[model samples]
Target: MTRPGFSAVSVLGVCLLFTLSGCSGTPAPAPTTGSASATATATATASPSPTAPTSQAVTPSPTATAPPSSAPPSSAPAGPTETATPTAEPTFTGFPEQTGPLTIYYVAIGDNGVSGPMIGCGDSIVATTTAPVRFTDQVGPSLGTLLVNKSRDVGLSGLVNVLYQSNLTYVGGELVGSTINIYLSGQFMLGGVCDIPRAKAQLEYTAMAASGATSAQVFVDGRPIDEVLSLK
Candidate 1:
């Protein structure tokens, strides 16, 4: 009643199992290596760190440059330039109390020279022995008024009004025949003229008049000259 050593049922079951395994054509899956897994884990961790490092910020140092100066502004210059100095005038000697008696002659010459008895340099009278004196106007206006035309005369006929004066020059103290001179000025109001210096001619003497006339008067140099010629 026991089955033979190789039972057909058992054998048929074993062959069927082998046939299914061959027809499925499946192989065993390979096991994962430890090194490969470790490499993969490192790569994943490094990739995530790339996005994280960009978060921090950087700064600069202290002690840079300095500022500008604190000084004030400037000022201006001062005043104008200056000029030069001036000059002075002239001088002469003094005079006497009275002039003594003297006789003078009048002479006629051509057109220009001294004319009657004139006083100059001192107290005496000096005679002009020439005709019409060509005189210089020394004061007032530079060129002055002419009282008379250039003409012939025995006496000085022009009248002069002294409007101003130069410094007084001294004619010496009077004696029997003291002589003197002067420089006068003139400007013509009535006529056109040039200036003349101590130019008028007259006779002067210290003799008392016989006609009860205290002062003497004479017609000379074409003018009536009234002069105190005496000490009476």
Candidate 2:
């Protein structure tokens, strides 16, 4: 009986002490655990790329330039040309020597084959053979009279086609009354006519001066005659 009564009192006292100790020793509950978080960061680097190779352009060569001219480049000189002096046209420096144009006065007295003659050319007073010169009213009863002067008497005038051409004419002469006249045509030597003889002329006369005068004597190259000559 005694033992049971003491245990109840002790058990009550021990319970009250345990309650006070627990209140004092307990720590504040860990702050609500903050939401756990972990963040990761990444960094990147860049490098430059190499450039491609390029090709170069080609150049042209220079050419030589020519001199300016009206025509073109040349080695010839420009100016008056040197011409050979036209050889002094083979001159006639002395007697009987002929060069440029020439004219001569001739007389035939030394040669004997020439004498009085009556003659005429178409529309021109030519010469007179050994016959009286026929006169007419239109021709005024007289063909021109002859003179003894050289170049003053009747000169040979006719077409070169019918007379002198490509030749030299040498003439002999004499007097007729108070007149001088040529009986023969010429003393010409032409390359074309040399081989051929000279042409002869016809003589027609009827005393135009004194009637019944001596029938004039005709002559050629100095040969006296009383007839007309035909030249062919």
Candidate 3:
């Protein structure tokens, strides 16, 4: 029954090839180990491990402070104070004593010619005296002598005592510094206008010469001699 050019030997050879193929086991699948390792690496990169929460340290800010003062303390004690003193003033004394024959001035007539002709009327001269005198004791006595009337009887010719009729008597005298104060108590009488000058000159000049004073003033009845003598 081989028909048509096909032979039994060809058919047997084909069958033998198929049988050999069946006896060998199936081939192993391709390895996936590399793919699995790649997948695990990707997962690890995508999901990072949770990191522990970090703690922060806190630094406090610096506090402000006040500066100290340069002045001294108020509790200390104070120092002492000083005071001043004042000065004083000066005083006065008296004059020296003198003694000798005294000179007395009296009013004279015609001594000054027409300018002052009558004695005691602005005319005068030093009268003569034989009696020695002490200057200290003569001030009262000298003024007393001028009160005597009648100059011709005392050898003083042309000299007039205008105060003889006034009844003025010499009191005590005081020598103060260079001045002599002669006190008199009396009634003041002048025979006429000419008698006034004669009275003043006789009293004042006698007082000065007797006391050796630079000036003299007469006081009568506790008043100035000029006031009393000014009577009309």
Candidate 4:
């Protein structure tokens, strides 16, 4: 039973077990090289996140620029900038009284440069009035209305109702034989003889009657009245 061959067999079995254990040792975890590769991949993923931040940073730039673009459109509505033209004089000059047996005849606007009827007002001068009536005096304080009222018997309307102030003034007169030169300053009315030839006829007749002149030459602002008015 105690054979010497038994110890030799036990020793052979022990050597076979040691060889199998060495072979199944998990190959030293493959030198842990795959873990290092996984870690590198994770680092690459983190690097790509930095690119995402760059993209995110650029997104805000467009948002900030959007407000500026919209702001210019808001200012576009401020367009209709125009200045108003002045149509009135600052201060009008004073009017003087009528001088020496002078008569001012008012001609209402009508057809053919002379209306249906004419109004001639004569005032006897105890002391000679100032030559040439002033704009203020001519249209002063309802004077035009009173003048219009005097011509009511002739069935004339809208003669004295000048809606706008006629920045007009009568200066001195120059008499050349039967032809008397009448001078006026500034504009008389918006219309002229061309528009209302009757009005011109009225004025001419009145001037001739007042100066006792056979003919009258009209001058406005030192220019011929014909030039200012489109006389027909």
Tell me each candidate's TM-score. 0.15, 0.17, 0.48, 0.34
lDDT of 4: 0.49
How much lDDT does each candidate structure score? 0.32, 0.33, 0.69, 0.49
lDDT of 2 by residue, 1-232 (tens): 5564657779888887898788888688764434222111111123434666668666777787856756544577765556777666686553332223111112222223233232222211123332343322211122122211113222452212112331212243333564333344324322342112222221213222322223333344665422323333
- Candidate 3 residue lDDT tens string, 11-91: 999999999888875977876999888888998899888988779777888888746645444566434434666665564
Poorest stretch of ten by lDDT in candidate 3: 113-122
Tens-place lDDT per residue, model 1, 1-232, is 9776978999999999999989897777766797778888988887765555655676667877746534333354333444656656555343323323222222222213444333332222233222222322211111121122233243463323221231222121122222322222222221111212222222122111111223332322323322211213
Question: What's the CA error at residue 162 for candidate 3, in Å?
Answer: 2.0
Span of ten consecutive residues with least summed lDDT in model 4: 120-129
Candidate 4, residues 1-232: lDDT per residue as tens digits?
Answer: 8665657779999999999999987765454788989988999988865433344444344434443332235545556657999888778454456434333333343322343343222211111122344342332222232223323233333343221334555565666999977776767554432333433444455566555578877777888877776544
| Clash pairs (backbone) in predicted model 3 | 108-119, 110-117, 120-198
Q: Residue 215 deviation, candidate 2, in Å?
A: 34
